[model samples]
Target: MADYLGMLKGEQLVSLSENFDYVTATADFVGLKLFPAVKTDNMKLAIAQLTKGGKIPVMALVHALDTEARIGDRPNYETMNVELMLIKEKLNQGEAIRKLIRDTGMKETESEILKAVFNDANNLISRVLTRVEGM
Candidate 1:
């Protein structure tokens, strides 16, 4: 929680943690050249919560004169997504949690504090994104 950094969604990257649906759901959710980080699965619950608060994903009207292309025997969008994910989403919060447990023993209200902080931060981020997108 120091100086801010940056993030994505698209299914170009898959984590063993997100094995619930098809491996390509993230990519399938968006078309092309939209939010480079277009994704919903990783934060599905968060977005849903914000939407319930009357927020929505930022959208655009893409207008192309010749938006036609031929499928070639080349790499697909998934490959690109994977590369983007490997480069972008590399933070391991799990390690942070482990260190907290080790250093503090996670005693007393620590567990509750951790849960509340994580949940609230996640929801707050979703709301912030929705608000920013609207602006």
Candidate 2:
């Protein structure tokens, strides 16, 4: 992400993680796309404590879009499709939660999580179902 963020001459770098929980959780918020080319709302931010990267529940907070101070080719940045991202989040989240329940030996209870995870995905998926499904 450091490259995408375009940081030159700095030790601080950014990298996107493979955890959908991060992205799925962000579906509930807002994100401002500084780049005009990208289309989406509710900026998503996923962060974890590097101090104990793999030892705790991941932490992420995204409430601002202030990058004016940073210098780079941000004016010509590319963005990801927020709609497709919904599919990734919903499917992956459902899988992960199920896996946790099955493998962690956690006592299972009423789980509305999957429903909630795919809550707003219907419209996003329906919009391109035919194309995606080859139907």
Candidate 3:
């Protein structure tokens, strides 16, 4: 089994597997080029193999592409690292959305909605952290 990264794009979930076979199979079935996390040389070979196996290459060249060929926004690692650090700093300082909302004197309904949003965001962050730790 391969550890696949799944990105949500609108109503579709685009999954990219680390395994070359898995990616090739997916591409063969869906008629989409699923990029694999491999060296440029290997990637080129994989692309050629997939094409030879009757899978249409959605992307021209794996090494030449600036970003991953997918429907969703590619994750910016640098931005994510900076934002994670900022979130940690804020948490350590006891800063939270509820406090900000209270300080700003938001209306009751608006405050509730903001609180819910923040709660969901925190949960998502926690889940991400857990996954990272497991890795």
Candidate 3's displacement at residue 98, Å, is 20
**Clashes (N, CA, C under 3 Å) per candidate:** 7, 4, 0
Candidate topping TM-score: 1
Per-candidate Cα lDDT values, in order, are 0.39, 0.36, 0.35
Candidate RMSDs in order: 18.8, 24.7, 21.4
Question: For every model shown, what is its TM-score relative to the native structure?
Answer: 0.24, 0.18, 0.21
Descending-TM-score candidate ranking: 1, 3, 2
By descending lDDT, how would the candidates be arranged?
Answer: 1, 2, 3
**Clashing residue pairs found in predicted model 3:** none
lDDT by residue for model 1 (1-135), tens: 211111112331233224433323333333222555455455222111222323344344565788754443422222112221222122344556555555765567564544533444445444444444454
At residue 126, candidate 1 shows an lDDT of 47
RMSD in angstroms, candidate 1? 18.8
lDDT (Cα, tens digit) per residue for candidate 2, span 1-135: 112123112232111222224334433322212221245575664443334234445434444576444332212233434323332322334456555545654335223432333343453443334333442
